[model samples]
Target: MITKITKFITPALLTLCFAISLNSCKDKPKKESTIVEEKVVYPSDIIPFMDEFKILCGDGKSYNDLVDVKHDNFFYVENDGTTDWVVYKSPNSGVTSRTSSNTRTELGQKKEWLPDTGGKLTGTLKVMHVSTSGDARVAASYAVVVGQIHGTEGHENEPLKIFYKKFPGHTKGSVYWNYEINTEGDNSKRWDYSTAVWGYDMSVIGDTPTSYPEEPKDGITLGEEFSYEINVYKGIMYLTFKSEGHETKTFTKSLIKTDFGKSKELPEQIKTLYASIGRDGSERENAYAGELQNFKQGAYNQTNGKDPEENMVWHTGSETYDGDINKQYKKGCYTEVWFKEATVGAGTPPEE
Candidate 1:
């Protein structure tokens, strides 16, 4: 009778221990739910072109490795809630290119080509800001250069300089392109011929710094989306400008030769625009033909902190504070631009 009772007590004790172990397992805390947030993609992540080009930032820093990388102030990525844009910003008084009195946060293509072989470059962008301080009588006042095709060899002149300019107290700005003259004899006599595609030319400015012009009813505003294609093929460069709610304008120019070889052949617009600056020279017979050229796209600020009296046309009397980036940008002496998409490649032949 005692042995049977012991057997029963042992079985009951084992079952009790098993039940206690199960309750302990159930009381343990579960792992906290992992929450993963999405990462913000940058401009280089969207358009990786580190292998094809080099970047010159507004801070005077050159970047050869740009893939998935960005600079804090000069070059960075901005997301406007719906779209991510590549921003190129430059202060008016910072370090600049050797040939011009401008600063840029722009891309320089690694490859070069001649007019005969040709090349194509396209960009969809908008001008966010330009220097707000400048003399109205100056041509570069309140203006920013957004794109260019610069010659790498020879005179190292620029074949194209696209600009977006707005006057103070105006609601809309102008979209124009300039063709720099390849001087036949003296480079000092060189000038740029501006052609308006959407609004007024560079010459349309106020009589004084305080005076104002009528707002362009059919012009582009700040942060408006616009695009340009510089396609050079078969010795001719074809340009296409497009923006929503505006006319799609197309233009063609001969890169192999100039149509304004003589003063008499110069377009009347050039005389009116360059008269104040004393630019009366004509382009060469063969314009930019056979010259090694490359594409440049980004914010090439036309404004500067120099004295307005030195060179009224290109020298802007904006606030530079001796190359202080913080002071320049805060004082509205800076240019900022954003690009959505871009491509660079060989020019495609048009179908006959």
Candidate 2:
């Protein structure tokens, strides 16, 4: 009986040893799990932002014509400031939703903005847009390059932001616009929303700004840019820009009179009406010879510096504008014009 008891005790001791060994292994910290979680941003989602970047550069649309689609990354917030997530291209890359990642504007911060990470490239647009305008009026100077975006990395075009469209009071190095463009897989459609838009020049009613102090007679005008709403319900696509010394143009994209199809001329009344706005060569005196006039007639540059007609876009002054009257008829500077019906372009106009 004693020997049998000993044999059983021996087996028990061995089992105990195995149990501890397994526990030791289990207690070992996992190395892989300790790694930081980075978001996986997709190229497709980021690429459309290129379109926003391009539109401001020289595309034939107003700044309002800018739209975006965003792609959100998987994020996990910890008690500490550290945020972890798999890096993936987000939806609406070009559309600014007031995310710290998209635009860093303190004017109107957006909901669900991950402040820690978003304060990067995507953040510049929002913050810069408002601040530049404000600074322009107070200081009566053009805001210098606050900085560049997406520089020399995944998106090479990031550096091109240095040339973003400039407003009247805002100069070339001073111009800025933040867009968190959320794209809907289809290139044809886009949504613009989550705006904390602000401007420096809070001018009076009916007062529009003109050119920048340093507006070069030689270069182009990146006049008032536009921002559209994501929902069709919101008309007057928010048209924001420096209104010279007056109220920073916090106007809406009023395309109510704008027809969907291209017009024979800038239309009849539109021409004389804008002239009353006090725009010089920036806006066409006759609607027939306006911004579209150059393109329709093949006047813009095609080969070398020559227009399709061999006329340089600069020589025409039909493109850019500056200063307090920036909101005036600056050519190439995009704004929403109301049309009776929708006949052309990618998206349908909002119902009147």
Q: For each candidate, what TM-score against the reference?
A: 0.88, 0.24
**Model 1 TM-score (2 dp):** 0.88
Off by over 4 Å in 1: 1-40
Question: What's the lDDT for all of these models?
Answer: 0.85, 0.23
**CA RMSD of all predictions:** 3.9, 18.2
**Most accurate candidate by TM-score:** 1
Worst 10 residues of 2 by lDDT: 290-299
Q: What stretches of model 2 exceed 4 Å from their correct place?
A: 1-36, 41-352
- Report the C-alpha lDDT of model 2 over 229-345, residue by residue, as the tens digit: 211111223323332332342433221222212332333422332233322122111211111100000001100111112211111122222221233212222221110111111
Each candidate structure's count of clashing pairs: 0, 86
The most accurate candidate by lDDT is 1
